[model samples]
Target: MYSTSTQKREWTYTPEKLAAVRLETNIKFREKYESVITPEELELFVTPEEELRMQRSIEDAALKFADKFRPHIWPSVKWTALAFFKRAFLVWMVMMGCFYLAMKIDEFYITIDDFVKNMNVGDPRQNAERILKLEPELMKVLNYNLTVHCPYRPFEGHLMDMKTRMLLLNFDLESIRRDSMRFFQNALQTDVLLVYPPSQIALAAINFGCMLKSDEILREFLRKMIGIEEDSWSARDVRPEDLEKLEKTVTRVNHIMREVEKQFVAVTEQERENHKSRLSQIQNLLPILNERRKEAWRAGGCIGQEPGLVTEAPVDSDDE
Candidate 1:
């Protein structure tokens, strides 16, 4: 279904495209503010990589919240929620709003008060209000696309295939399933979901799971699934280049997983504190930037209101 989905047509990007898009976005940011802010102020802006790291931290925190959510959130819902976060660089509040939206879209509805309480967001009424106000923006950022296909089902399919078709894999498939599930969980923290097809991700997880089990099992799985022997000159159907490409992709996914894990482990509390400090600088700069934009709009005879300002009203403190 992913082959025929809108996600494949519109959302998917090659590695080069992704890098070019990030470069263009950064260029646009500088172009927008170069005239309004001093060079020193502009120098304070976070680089694209730093911005990505900050977003990843917030995303990991959101994932933890989703894991502990009551009534047990679906894996699909969690993946969809993260997809939204990755698509847009939003603040912590809006990220939660995205999660709430993903839940509703996935038919896992929880009352706003319940969500606030269960998520331990302080001041239920205010938090609910904030989430509601930002819901539309989150939806718009996602382009109202709610359907996200994750690798879990395909992952299970691969396990089932192995159990049914591969007689050589006579050992308990449950162990492989468990290891694959963990690999998939760790993959969620990386860009594999965005960069690779679900089937490929599933295959990579299975491959890693087999590797964790034993080298013999790994060799067998690779032999059956990847047709390792088919690469021989006697093979008539399979192209060597195609097989090479497949192997490269699987290796790349594993490499990405390890690299991202290293990056996550390297992040110290002081590094996070530095990120917050940089955020404060941006926050302080936004009001001036907004005012300048408003002035320019007014000069063009177009009235505009200030954005990103939340007016908190007195509301119920006890949402229980």
Candidate 2:
């Protein structure tokens, strides 16, 4: 039989108590992660009233400038056919320039020859990185995505939810947003999107992106997402499997993106020549490595020394 206090404690979880607990949990969740960009706001193409006000202000300023210029230029025939023709000519010039660019795009396409060392590479991760690192002018050729999922949407959603809180925390929100989005973009540049769920991939991106911007905030922000108290969020306490997955995902992300970053960093002609010079100076190190291996084997007794080197010529029973 249970003690009276035990029975009372077990029965203490009443309907009202359960309701209150659930409500409290909901409130806590909202405090930590309520989406700052609501669904309606997301759906709107332009909801920020400030943007509209800015546009209107610009238009009003332009009109006021025109009105002021009109009287001063009126004596110079401001409304003359020559002025109208000048406007038309400028518009035609812009149109023709645009048309020429469109037609001669191939001639103007930006390129850096042979970014990837192996063109015939079959690794999906490597291949994807190659495509992503291809000249930005090649973006039009690569626009249509065939990946199983676009992680950008999910990542943007997650970022929208936490952006305000991150700002309040004195983080450089713009840097975080930019880098995090780039990380997500890089994840798509590899087979990582296929290997991991977009959300998990995004979590990995958030981890790395935070590191790139401000290493200190990564753990603290992750703890906020996990809804744990500051002291209770020690990273070392995470389960081994979970930690391994997170670490592996971040490792793969960094590897894939590092190559993409190389494209942005200029490789000067001198540097290229120096690289070639280093290659020419390089001898086949395989033989040296092999010799070291053999020496290690001999040291470990895995390989025998020269014949009779470590042994007596004979074990003379008479001597013994």
Best by TM-score: 1
lDDT of 1 by residue, 1-320 (tens): 88877566656777667667666776777676776677888888767776777766666667778889887888878888887777665222257888888888779888888888876646888999988999976766655555677888887887876786667655787777777767766666666666777877777677767775664554455556665663466656666775676567657656655644554443466776777688778889978987886676667787554433445444322111
Residue-level lDDT tens digits of model 2 in 1-320 = 21222212222234345345445543543332222324442332222232223222322332233335411322112111122211222111111122112222313232222212222335646644544553232312212111123345566666776675456665545566667655543332222322334455565566567775565564555545555455656766666665565456556555544534532223345654554343233223323434555666667787655321324233212100
lDDT of 2: 0.38
lDDT (0 to 1) per candidate = 0.70, 0.38
| Best model per lDDT | 1
TM-score of 2: 0.28
Q: In angstroms, how far off is 255's CA in candidate 2?
A: 9.4
Candidate 1 displacement at residue 86 in angstroms: 0.7
| Lowest summed lDDT window (length 10), candidate 1 | 311-320
